[model samples]
Target chain A: MGTTGTDIRYLVIIGIAVMLLLFTSFLLALIFNQRKKLKYQQSMEKLREQQQNQLIEAAVRSEETERHRIAETLHDEVGAILSSAKLHLLGIKSDILDERDQQLHEKGRELLNEVIQKVRGISHNLHSNILKEFGLNEAIRHFIRKIAQGTVLHATTALDDNYKTENPDNDISIYRMVQELVNNILKYANATEFIVSSTHRGNELDMVIFHNGDGLTQEQFEELRYQKEGLGLKNIQNRIILLKGSIHFTSGSEGYRINIHIPVKSNQP
Target chain B: MKLINFIRDWSEVWALLIPLIIILVFKPAKKQLRPVILYVFAGFILNFLATFMVEYYYLMPSWTYTDGYVNNNILYNLHSFVRVLFLGWYIISVRQYKFPFLLKTLLIFYLVFVITNFTFYESPFILSTRLYAAESITLLVICLFYFFRSMQDESDINWLKHPSFLIAAGISLYEVITFFIFLFFYPLHQKDISFAAVTMRIYTITFVVFCILLALALYKSRKKSNLSGVTG
Candidate 1:
């Protein structure tokens, strides 16, 4: 009986030890398998995000291409036609006409000149040739200058001279976001003073805009961004997301301020 | 020999304190964790009482004895019942299984079975091997069901860090480790008392590990809730 008891003790010990070893192995397996699954899920999420960004880039690029086409057609074809019409109208012998006819011709010439000037301004705004040639800094300063000239708003820019364009695509995205925000301010803020500033710090580019007008807070921007009427703001957000950047809106004592930060990726090779 | 006796006498009782202290100190106030809190608190109390009864059953009232022997088996029997009840409640409340009616029915049936089995066939003062087997099997089934249901869930939760997964894993490991020993405990004890003691020590070791796992689960749960509170 004593020998049998000793054998049984050994057997139970072995059994429990085996059971514990097996359970440990099983747990480790479960953890590793689940970790593998999580990795796969994360990669799939990254792939989906990459695909979405590609779609947004394609849409924005196509829109820019269409704008360039329209601007070129207007500037080259329509402007030439209008200029020729002006010269022909001017060449008409006004001296041979009655006084009333001469007045009508002069008025017609004035309207044609105004139309030509307006067309030129529209073409310049749409084409973005200055942005392509001069980069984001000059483009933004030029935009602010145009705003200051064309509206009652006193707009100013203090862009960083050290800021160099590493990627034109990213620059275009930044320019578009700034353009949209400025437009929003002009259309709604009703304030007179607006300022745009940029600073390049190491590998980060920070841009801030201040306007002394009624503007959006971060919460309001979040709320408005999901509404149907906020498509422009949503597009701006999507572009910022593609650029892997962030935009913050705040209302200070003076008025409103927007801060944008983008990580500068060096794609120069 | 003294070490073995000490371990055999107090391992499970002391192990319960680990998770109990964690729950008390951390105070995971989430509604989903309430059942776990109650389970650990109640388990600690019951286990402490059982350990005390084992050491001092001779000084207790006659009603606590059977056939002139100090018998603390009733406390173990009671723990099995509480174990199923609280753990089952945790599953029902947290998992919200699809066929909740079925699980509730099973709980009711198990409760009735425990009462009837103790009243008629088995003296609660003696180790109720039947109750241990029934409890282990039931809990094992519930733990397996939890894993299966978690498999079907589409949420991208880290299963390793998930409190529910940890609880299920702890429970399942304890159940599997002790199932056979508890199943044949009565026969083995009668055949060779020394062998039975050895098996009980092994059970004690597993119980200690199980309690540590429970403590970890509670800690993880608290951390997760705090994180969500900050981010939400």
Candidate 2:
């Protein structure tokens, strides 16, 4: 009886200890399992993000390619035809005609000249040859000069000359973003002044735009970027995401400002 | 000596009180945690009475005695009842399961079983091993379901730090460790008092760990307003 009692005692103790050990093992297994699940979920999210970025990159690239095609066609084909038509109109002798006929001939020449200028301007705006040759800084300057030509809005640029272009594709993206922002400002913002400034520090390029106009706050930008009408903003965001950069918008009582930060990879070595 | 005895007798009370105070002090999002708070409060009150009776039952009037022995098992029985009720309520409130009606029916059936077993077959004043076994089984099954569902969840939440996970873990730990002991508690006590005492001590230690986990869950919880408001 004594031996039996002692054996029972050992069995109970062993059972309890074993159960505890099992529970501990179970908890460890649970934690490890959860960690594995978490890693899997994170990898899945990253995969989705990469796929979405690829789609956006493809879309943006195709859009740029189409714009370049249309610009080349306009410049090389339509501009040449318009210039030839103007030359043919000019070849006629206006001095040998009556006063009214000469006046009509002069008007035709003036109209043809204006039509040629308009076509050329449209082609340049669509795809800037300056952007291809002189880089982003000169192209932006040319853009500002063109927009502020006869408009009430006084625009200025304080771009850093220290910037050395390494990626032309990134330059085109930056130029397009600037163009979209300025166009949005012209369409919606009833302001009289705008400033586009750039600073190159170390490996980062910072472009800050300040305007006395109604502009979106960061929250508003985030909210609007998911909307249908915000396609342009979405494209800008896609470009920023592709460049692995950030864009911040700030609005004050006096004016609004947007800061674009991009990490520029240098090839100076 | 008296103070030492008091501490020894009321050890589980102290363990239960820690989480109760933490939950009250932290004031976790009350909308989701109301059932948990209620369970803790109910458990604290029941445990305090049960411990108090164990310590001071000799001073009580004779009418309070059952079969000439001071039996505080009914308090523990009530504690078991509320433990299942409020814990089940907390689970039901949070998750959108397929069979809520079935869960509600099961809870009702559990109450009926407790009443029938205590009234007809076994006295509540004496520790009802059957009732405890049933409670432990029900809780274990519920916790298993909770775990299975949580494993399949795809949210970006850190389950290790989540309050629901911690509460489920605490309950599961307590249930898993002490289940067989409760199932054979009477037989073991009849055969060897010393062995039963040791097992009961293990139960006490497990309860302490459970309370600490509950405290951690409460600490990790945040107010609903804090959860909703976005910071710049």
Evaluated with TM-score, which candidate comes out highest? 2
DockQ of 1: 0.27
**Model 2 per-residue lDDT tens digits across residues B169-196:** 8888888777778876866787878878
Q: Write the per-residue lDDT of candidate 1 for residues B63-129, one digit (tens) a residue.
A: 7777777677777888888888888778766775788787778788888888899888987877788
Against the native chain B, each candidate's TM-score is 0.88, 0.89
TM-score of each: 0.78, 0.79
Candidate fnat values, all: 0.21, 0.19
Pairing residues by index, what is the TM-score of model 2?
Answer: 0.79
Locate the minimum summed-lDDT window of 10 residues in model 1 chain B. B223-232
Model 1, range A43-65, lDDT digits (tens) per residue?
A: 99999988988888898898789
Per-residue lDDT of model 2, residues A1-269, tens digit only: 34454566776667667766766766676688789888888899899988987887798899988998998999899999998898888899888999999999999988988888888898998885899899999999999999999888899999999997878888888899999998888888887999999999988999999999898788888888889999998888888987778888888888999899988885245
The CA lDDT at A254 in model 1 is: 79
Instruction: List clashing residue pairs in candidate 1.
Output: none
Q: Is the docking of candidate 1 incorrect, acceptable, medium or high quality?
A: acceptable
